[model samples]
Target: MAWDDKRVETWVGIMLRTGVMIAAAIVLIGGVLYLSGRGPSPRNNYRHFQGEPAQYTSLSGVVHNVNLHEPRSLIMLGLLILIATPVARVGMCIAGFLLERDRMYVVVSTAVLVILLYSLFFHK
Candidate 1:
């Protein structure tokens, strides 16, 4: 397939829109699940700066909770997917550049992808 700037823009727009929509749906469902019951907040301390639960703090923890259909985990998963959308766009850019025989952009996109992956997987 011949890639052009217009095609790149269209691809990026579609990716971003789809990612946001899916994430929004997940978050909305999770929010519904979380708010449907569980009664009122303890002591009505809505202003308190309580941190997130330990289960939502790590990748494995989130996955474990998600297996149990935990609402917060589902919400966090949506946020993670939202965050990953741009990374996926960068990957697509790399492929597009390769297809277009644009060596410089291919290299640049690869570097950016590597940096994103490093930050996501190892920088923590």
Candidate 2:
């Protein structure tokens, strides 16, 4: 059982495909729930710009809302998962490089991961 480049690539491909599929499924379910629950005559207030609720703005808040089985929060969760897929792929690459003792790639992957995290969380 050797951890070769081909093996890593295969796993990465599987991970990406699985992540996207799961995220899409979650979003679809959430959308169905939302549409079913919303009775006829839905609110279509478009004059004023409205933002997401405070609970959905933060990760903790989104998780809390999801715990309560909120449809919007579930959709948010799906989106979050979708966004995280690439980040996780980068992390997996880092690990794969580390296992192969590839210093150059490990450093490059780490830098990329740091930049990604910064843009995702720290950018103003």
lDDT of each: 0.83, 0.89
lDDT of 1 by residue, 1-124 (tens): 6788679868888998999999999988888887765557664466878877798777667766784346777889888889889999999999888878999999999999999999887786
Tens digit of per-residue lDDT, candidate 2, span 56-85: 877677766785256878899999999999
Give model 2's TM-score versus the native structure.
0.87
My TM-score estimates for the predictions, one after another, are: 0.85, 0.87
Counting clashing residue pairs in each candidate, in order, gives 0, 0
Clashing pairs in model 1, backbone N/Cα/C closer than 3 A? none
Clashes of 2: 0
**Candidate 1 lDDT trough over 10 residues, lowest sum:** 37-46
* Model 1 deviation from native, Cα RMSD in Å: 2.3
- Using lDDT as the measure, the top candidate is 2
Model 1 score (lDDT): 0.83
